[model samples]
Target chain A: MWRIAIYETVYIIIYGLYTVFEFICGMFEYVYQTVFFTCHEFLFPSEKRARLKELVSKIKKKPKHLTVLLGPEDAEVTDLANLVIWCLASQIVFISFYDHKGSLKKKEEKLQLEVKKHSGDTAQVIWYTDENSNLENGFKGSKVHVKIITDEDSKMSAATITKLLVESENEDFTIENIHKHFVKQFRFPDPEMGILFGKDYCFYNYPPWQMRLTEFFRFKSAKSITYAQFLNLLVKFSQREQRLGK
Target chain B: MSWVVDNQLTRFQKFCVNVIKCGPIPRHIAIIMDGNRRYAIRNKMGKTEGHTKGFERLAECLLWCRELGVKEVTVYAFSIENFNRTIEEVDTLMSLAKEKFERVFEEKDKIMMEGIKIRVIGNLSLVPEDIRILLAKSVLLTKDNDKSILNIAFSYTARDEIVHSMKTVVEGLESKKIKPADVDADLISYCMYSNQSPDPDILIRTSGEVRLSDFLLWQISQHTQICFTSVLWPDFSIWHLLGCIFKYQRAFPGLKKYADECQSNRKKLNDRITSFLGDIEKKRMEQMEIYAKT
Candidate 1:
């Protein structure tokens, strides 16, 4: 009985200590991230621009298509607009914003306006779902093409695509042809990188079909996403090697 | 000499695990086991030897998971893209897989006693006949075990799984059994190879890789906790798994909230879709029947 009591006591003590340690570490991380974000925010516009440019230069390879997965807390239009402007500055051709609730999609016009305000008059922003958006044109004149997706898009696309295939005269369904249909439906290439802004690491039903090779980077919260952190993700993405099962 | 130390270490590990069991435990876990070749190179061993070590590590991890009360484990054993590797390496991997399956079959009694069901997910037609037969037999042998599930993703890719589900849906539509309106996210999910299990609570990828690498893309929801560690597959230890579980527990409350919200939203969407389909349901069914007859 005494031995069992001693073992239980030891277990409790160790577990308690570990939990406390984890709490302390989490607090430290929160403090560090806040301080880092504030430091970047305090930088002069010119200095920040220079820093962004430097970071972009350091990236040897950049993803042409980027998807941002936003948590409920991070679904602010202004923050998304800032992200779009940053992507435009970095020359990413395609950007997709995914929020599970479709809140961002509802505020698309506001997001577009905010992006345009920061991206300048010369930068053309094309919404992929717009009637004028042509898949073949492929960001020819547009500085960046944006697509705002929600859970509905993923579910609807699958149903719609399946219906199209079933209705079509062709009996054969190959991956190549199915992929073509999806590309046509999406009007954007598959995302090469996915940036998640949330307290937890979850995709929230970000399009499964397009994320086969997407390298995901996570930020603690999307509310105060800094340019430096964004640039760092880009650099990290560039450095990582993808074997694609080779 | 080492047996004594190992026994003592296992006792300590049991104590740790018992304490961990006091918290919220993940019901399902997925793993992307990577970096075998790198581990081999680092240790100056043959690549095959590293793979063997990785398999050993998997056994250890599964034991730990079972002790920790995880009911389902899905492992990325092989990918469809892995067929592009050198012929010799691919051959070795197939043989290794066959040998492992045979061993599992030989230990069927033990597996049955443990109530562990074995499932091989993915495009099985792509594998060789002999290995396919072995996998089928192993799955059959353990099909009745319901306490736990071990999903081995062989010849699998998320895209292919999606495509497979699409093909199934197409077949259903062609047969006039289900109309186009019947197809939805839940339908696609049901047709997926992993339809038997719930979405994983934790996804751990070894070797510091940050990508999903075409593993369970359709099933990963906002509730899943993803952990990427730098440790290679052969070097992965119980501590790493415990750490992952610890993180999951720490984030469980928030994850549960999001999961509940998603579930409710999905229910609402399904209701809306059903209501929307109600108006045109007859016409779609008639059209589907006409198409099927033709």
Candidate 2:
């Protein structure tokens, strides 16, 4: 018992010294990084973005077919766009959905600028919510190949969704028909997968067809919320190992 | 004719409508309502005054939620950690809760008496004797209220809930009331503070923070979460509440999960309703035609 007491005393002293060292290291680490991500990044009293960053970098090495959903007003989107272009330029598939309205001339011009900025060398698909276009309640349908959902106003159909649903089902309900319908709504001729961004998870049902038990991550911000953070989100989601049949 | 498809859809607007239409809307919604001090200081006020204003806001929000079909609303009124605050402010908060609860008991107002049941969740072991007794009486009198439930997580926590359940479950096992095989997540959950309330369908927080802060930690899962940063708790209005619900609808879209793509294999739920409505419309039209022909 006395030996145990001495062991505990030595253990406490060593841990105490280790704790002090960690505190000093933590202060220096935080001091180095001033400009972090958005308000949600700092919401946690404990700033632990480093663990998230480490995970994101791990995913980047394996480099699966990745998509980055873009928000129009956020600085984080710009930071991400730049990160992909500068670092893992070939690894990522940067996608965006912005307002493709106004004069046919002005809309096209705006799309050109946005595509150039956000898409880098990656492919771009601008949102089309026009009359002749196929959409089920603004977004969703058989025609869409890629589903890029973000919290942008011009991208969602709002309350007119009921009408969009009515239109999507103008024909008889069939599996092949529904598949065709979704393809038309997304407007992406060959969109293989869908990606939801972490910036604004206020999903107004974009790509309403595809998001059946899809994995999601409320990611850390862009600047300081490193590539490893994104990688970690993917890793955590991959490990969940759920069967969708239920 | 007003269906102008030329205009574009914004992300926030679409997100709002989709989530509300999804699953069963929560009849009783609970919240932590944290960051009033941070919010108040951001608006330039003393820390102590923030809680005072948040209290008044809480009173008004109860009426608003009741009117909006929220049967019950629970909030973390005070926590065990809150006892660590300055003695003067903690005393002031205790007195305020006692005074408010007393009025709720005495007031014959329909809003106070009708169906709205109020309960407090926490360890009462540490509360003052008078305050604890008053709480008990308030819970007793409000037991018959059927309209809604308002649960306050004062000094409540998930860890305590787990410990409390463990003790009870252990006793049951020792007494041979429940077998070991019956031990599961559901059994432990049934013994939780939120077992009386349906799992919160939607959890909303204000002042823009996203962490759960140990509030309803066990009860919330896959529930639509909405955190509005710009709105403070006191100024949290009906309009904003509508916005939150609408946003909740947009988040969950309930569309695809129902789609199944195999329409024939799946039960036609909506088409059945639409067909029913169509038959009613048809019968009415036929009767009107018969009348017109006559």
Candidate 3:
């Protein structure tokens, strides 16, 4: 009888402990979800989203062309696709991605497909891996036009521009004329701002001509870019006063 | 405890020094000496007093550059826009330039002994005549020294330099000394303010400003790596300068390759232009000979 009584007491204690453990786990899960939701919501603030939408909707001027430099890190193609989708949602008409090395062929193809699937014929996405590509072809309509610039593009641009300037100046060349012709021929627009998503805040030669008056914004890493980060960057860029090399 | 921490920091700095030495060093450096007025305002000091402190800092920076094996240093001393400031400020700056140039002239022997070549690159005609004379004398004194170059851009603006080059090119075209076909980037570069100095490899601007500020705009477009810092000019230290060099080292290989490619491209075009000019000269000489015989 005594042995039976001891077993009953131990069984009660074990059951009580099990109940406490389950309660603790439940509390932890609830806290975890609350923290995650808060962080997620912080990036998607209603006020900031409203400000960005309002600023972009003004139609007061053409949407500013922004170029983003990807660093040496192996950022996923899905992240790039997400960035494009967010940019479209935010009403940024033109976006450019410049990498120092040439774009990965398979990855670029996949990215193009993904972008096409997302935006359909509404967006013109061109992967410019070399100088021979038709650089002056697009930027019509109200669609978002995305251009992927590789190192080869910058090299070719420099070489071709220099050759054209040198050859034409012999005929009738002034700096002003060279610039006008180059702009018209290359269809190059001076980027209003360049966002460098690299570990180190450095320009990896993002086509020197396009960056003459560009205000550069640097971020630590672009591996997992969120929509809130993109809109926040645009908000910050709107507030920056460009002296234009006074 | 503080002494121990200092020792560890010193050891780390030495490690950085060793790492930097293993890489290629920048041969030429350009500095936009900015933020003197801001520094003065922050410190509640007079503007001229801030400038005086800046000069002292420059002297120390020169020694640091020399130690780092930098062959040339260019300082953007005064921009043309500076004249638009209050007359009191302008007069103070001009007097300061005169004093500094006079000192450099007075120490001509020491400058020559160190093989330091000092050149003033700007539209010097705008400067007061006495200061211009002193600048000319200083340049003449240090013309032969080849050890190091100190280019002081006084009364200078990049746009003015480009315009001057264009005018010179036009004059050449009119004189028929050079044909229109021969005008290229190389020829234009040769006509700029710092023609004697190679393009700067590293450009450092203080006071956290990131723009080029119209300083060396054309020359630096090729492959120059820029470093911007928040430290005021007066507080710029050797460590900051070394940190900049380390950043340059990181960028050196890629930039050097690009610069080399550009050089080769220019060389090819220059050669073609040269051969064309030579052929033209040959034809003219043959025509002259025929005319003589006739």
Candidate 4:
């Protein structure tokens, strides 16, 4: 009984010491993180662009397909233009864009011209929601393909697909059939990397049919997006070994 | 630290709580509590100890959610793939689960008093029969409670859930209870393991893991705001949750619009199916009336 009491006392003392030490460490960590985050918020815009550029140049393996999700407020023609230039420079073969409100029609012409001018190599641009053009004419021949996804397109495709499912043979509609319809309707490439340019890490219902296994990277703001951030995201994605839910 | 410092920390936490409560908080939050084993390794403790600490943290987190006014919280407690681990580890986990479930039963009165509803989702058949019984008992005890919900995903995977849902639909069809025209997104969703709760508005994955690991893949991938943190599950704090809420608040407007769009899409599909069903029902009623007259 005495031995047991002595052991318990020693254990209690050690445990108490550990708890106090952890508490002190936690306080220090909290203070350090708060200061660092505050400073970064003020200096991130200017420093991040240069760091991202350096990181991009260091990346040896570039992602084949990259998708960018623009916040409702960040969906500007100029931002898209910068993205196109960065993609062309990095040799990222395919880029897809989705705006929350789906208002890219007014910027299509300017976007196309900007891409043509900035795209040193050949590239094909298609509006996924374009009613006049069929799938055959959409991507006839191009080294790079850019598709602008919109809400209207998704709604139309969803209606047609649901109609097809309802008409199909008894309760046999499965994931494959739904997936096939989505692929045929949207013709989207499976993006290996997805970059979200906003504070929140969300897809915002952007082409939900794809992006099952895409690696997502969140940037603080989309207002002053730099190639470096894009490059950093790519490098980070390349380093990741996606288990794909295995 | 001195009492003054501790008081200041509490004040700061309260301030953050006030700010988070100002905006539209997420109705449902799903968490993938990862990195317990890593925490064990880092802290030089046994794996079981890490899990025990994680459980304690989870209990604290549930109380935090209750205080934060979060209605529903679902946690990825165990994945279907976790069964593939070494026999010893699996045994440990099963026993742990049994103990936790038993504890729930032991605390039935307190749980009831708190209005907590505990639900265990996933295929219970795969669990040890004894643990499964304990789980069911806890769930039964908490069945009437409605203040808050806690969904524990055990031996669960989103694909398995989807497959099970599909099987349910197929069975319904085979029995002639459901027509091909009646099948829609909402119907399929209702058959999922998570049908008991609404789709998570915000998802959190801890331990620096960016992938979903097959948690709620079909439900929340489109519209849910996800926050990934490097903190181990045992180390997760209310401050981390608050930061995530701040992020969610910033993105809520766009997310809400997207959610509205998805709802409208589902509504349109449902409307089409409903009209078809209405026609069929009308014909069936007419035939029944004529037969009755005869």
Candidate 5:
């Protein structure tokens, strides 16, 4: 009778204990999702951390020359900014973001504050997106040299303005932008960037100068993205075979 | 050395001359010869006959790729997903493989003498044992071929290649020589079966599918993708390939493609998180099982 009682007790503890353990796991998952995913909750799951931690081995303090293209804001502009910050923090890679904060002249004037605040002491390109602009107070000393993406003699599309920002004057890259005036500035490239956060095949034509052979990665939506998601993209990217032009 | 020739000339005699002239092209031009089933049903043939016809066309096209200066050519002969077909159909495919490999062996095609290697890519373990042995011997006999590389993607899926690569990386990571952080696109590419060759410069797919259908997913990023609608793959000619190449050459001057930004670390975490709880539906389900059981 004592053995039977002990058996029953043991059985109750084993399976019932498993049930409690499962209950705790469910609670942990709920807490993880609600806190980390829903709120700016700090503790990330191991799977989520796997990609970034994997890249920790390949951090380049100073990689080969880096080219930065400033993009105009639509909806996901801030997302792009966070991405840049994350990219920069991960390595001392070369970066040049934009001077154009908003379209309004006054807002654009005040936009230098965000540039100054975030740029700290980074290389910058404060070139005007248009052929000519009256520059006076707000645009005085943005340490990096400013080069005009479009000249008066050579008009270009608005969508391709950002590509023109690449320092190298690859004619093939610039030719596509000569006449196309796009409004948004950051759209899809020929081969879009893998970590892009935008919809539509329509490239807003930022700097049409630099995009000679850009890989295009399109996102139908960027509303619910997190830093961890960006890392995941890099992980997927690392597995790609970049067979450029045969 | 005129690279541009109009293969669509109305004259049949003109077609013969053009075929003779098309040479010095890329040695290994792989084709995703899709749309056999639909083509067969339209022609009032059953699906099984459709595949046999497709097989015939494939054999014929190899002769064309060979004649026109292509040393090696690959065809997406079967996809892993295609295993979902009826067992009878799969049996028919195995029979076809046996017969085809036997014919290639019996004829002692000059290609074998010239050192053209015949490889069956993708998960061949799923194939029947006998068929696998025949494939093994074909590969072995042609292993030293320097003339051309012929890859048949039987039960192939590109994304699965990536997943397979990731699993391989875990093994590499365990060895401590390959740090997890050192894993990048180039590293992964170098480890793949096709890493020896440059990614196919021109990926030609028949049946007018806009999407790559997971064909050569990792290898192709900036290659010229050619999709044809009117011509069924079996009926495709070497002229068809040349015509598309000419068009690609013309478009080259205008369309610009870019390489990816090389990175060391951490972007993976961000992208992974954003993509899901929604990637690799199979593994995710398994992981969900753990969490659900809890």
Candidate 6:
């Protein structure tokens, strides 16, 4: 019993010290990133677009489908629109935005307007919802498809698809069939890259069926996301070698 | 003097561990133990030797997690994709797995005392018969213990697990045992191999991998904290475990809030689906009954 008491005392004292240490480290990182990002932005204001374009050109392998996990703190529609325009510029055909609260999904029109404003006549933006919709065939030249995903799209789709397969009498309900259904339903290929804009690296329930081989990266803050950071992430994605369980 | 210093160093380490225990600890932790082969190459050892060292590290990690009050742990022991490896390596891994399960028998009394329940979550049909028997025996032996759970994801992939769950649901529906209304996210989750425990609170991947690599994609929610470390599996230490736990503690509050919100949202979706599919459920039951009669 006395041994337990001594251990508890030591634990309390050490825990206090540990928290203090962690706080100091966190503050230092925050300050460093703030200064560095601000200086980088100020120092290279005019060359930002060209540099981003150059970085994009340098990426040999670009992800066809990219999913962004937006945290509550980073759910700004304007920032999301900027990301969409960036994806268009980089020739990424499919981009999906996910926030747990479904706040972006509610304001889909405003987001589309924002994207239109930024993308102008350079790109055709198609908002994809499901496979059977006529919008699925609307893809043509210079087309970008944007999906606003929420928690409902993950498990709910699984249940609904399972129900459909179970009810279909003539069709063979196999894994491959399910995969085809999902591809048609979601109208997007499996995400090759996923970026999380949050303080931590949680997916927040991004579609489980789609992220089997997705390489995920994290951005510190969505509010201060820069072109360089996005370029760096693309470079990182290009450099990664996916073994796919081999 | 060296021995004395070592003793004191270990004592301090113990003290540090105790301090960490004062914070919020993850109830369940999952790990993607990567870079065993890399460790082997780096150390100029055979691949088998690296895997052996990785297994030793796993044993050490389990002990540390138990000490820290983590109730459940799931590890990516082997993947279905690993079947593509060289025949010699595959045979070695199978033998190694067989040997480990045999040791489980030798340590039965200790395992029982520790109250660790052994569970192998994956497609068991893929394994050889002998290793499968040993795995089944270990699971049966430790079935009653409840103090902690060790889930070995052998011959597993997240896609395979999801498919397995969907197959179960589909089979149930075909047999008229389950209704269409009953198939929801929670139900699908319950059908998963790792459904015995809650979703992991923290998933740590060693060797600097930022990908889930087909591990627990459905089970991990938006709130599951992920920690990617550059340490190889064989080189992973208790300090690394402690560091992961500390990070989990710092993020616990935000994670809990997000988890709660997700739970409510899931419930709402389930309820909506149930109501919407009520008529379809009746029609499906009738169809199944007729099919059964024919």
lDDT of 4 by residue, B1-294 (tens): 010011223756654565467567888999999888889999999999988888878887887777779989999998878888888888988888878877776666677878988777787767777776676676667777899999999888775676566556555555566677666556666666676678898999999877677678767756898999989999999989987886687678878887888777674445544454454445433543443233
lDDT of each residue in A152-194, candidate 4, tens digit only: 4443445445545444643554556556766787776667788
Who is ahead in DockQ, 3 or 4? Answer: 4
Supply the global lDDT for candidate 2: 0.49
Evaluated at residue B184, the lDDT of candidate 4 is: 56
TM-score of chain B of each: 0.87, 0.73, 0.85, 0.87, 0.75, 0.87
DockQ computed for model 6 against the true two-chain complex using alpha carbons: 0.56
Q: Which ten residues in a row have the lowest lDDT in candidate 2 chain B?
A: B1-10
Report the Cα lDDT for candidate 1: 0.79
Once fitted onto the true fold, the runs of candidate 3 whose alpha carbons sit more than 4 angstroms away are A1-63, A70-116, A119-189, A197-210, A220-224, A235-239, A242-246, B1-23, B83-88, B123-131, B157-191, B251-294
The best candidate in terms of TM-score: 6
> What shift in Å separates residue A32 of candidate 1 from its native position after superposition?
5.2
- Assess each prediction's global lDDT (C-alpha) against the native: 0.79, 0.49, 0.67, 0.71, 0.48, 0.80
Predicted candidate 5 versus true structure: per-residue lDDT over A118-195, tens digit per residue: 655643434353444234445443333222222111112321232232223323322223323222342212222322
The residue pairs found clashing in candidate 1 are none
True contacts kept of 2: 0.01
Off by over 4 Å in 6: A1-54, A129-141, A170-174, B1-9, B264-294
Better of 2 and 6 by DockQ: 6
Runs in model 1 deviating more than 4 A are A1-54, A129-142, B1-9, B265-294
Candidate with better TM-score, 3 vs 5:
3
> Which ranking of candidates, highest DockQ first?
6, 1, 4, 3, 2, 5
Q: Is candidate 1 or candidate 3 better by DockQ?
A: 1
TM-score of chain B of 1: 0.87
TM-score of each: 0.86, 0.47, 0.67, 0.71, 0.47, 0.87
Best by DockQ: 6
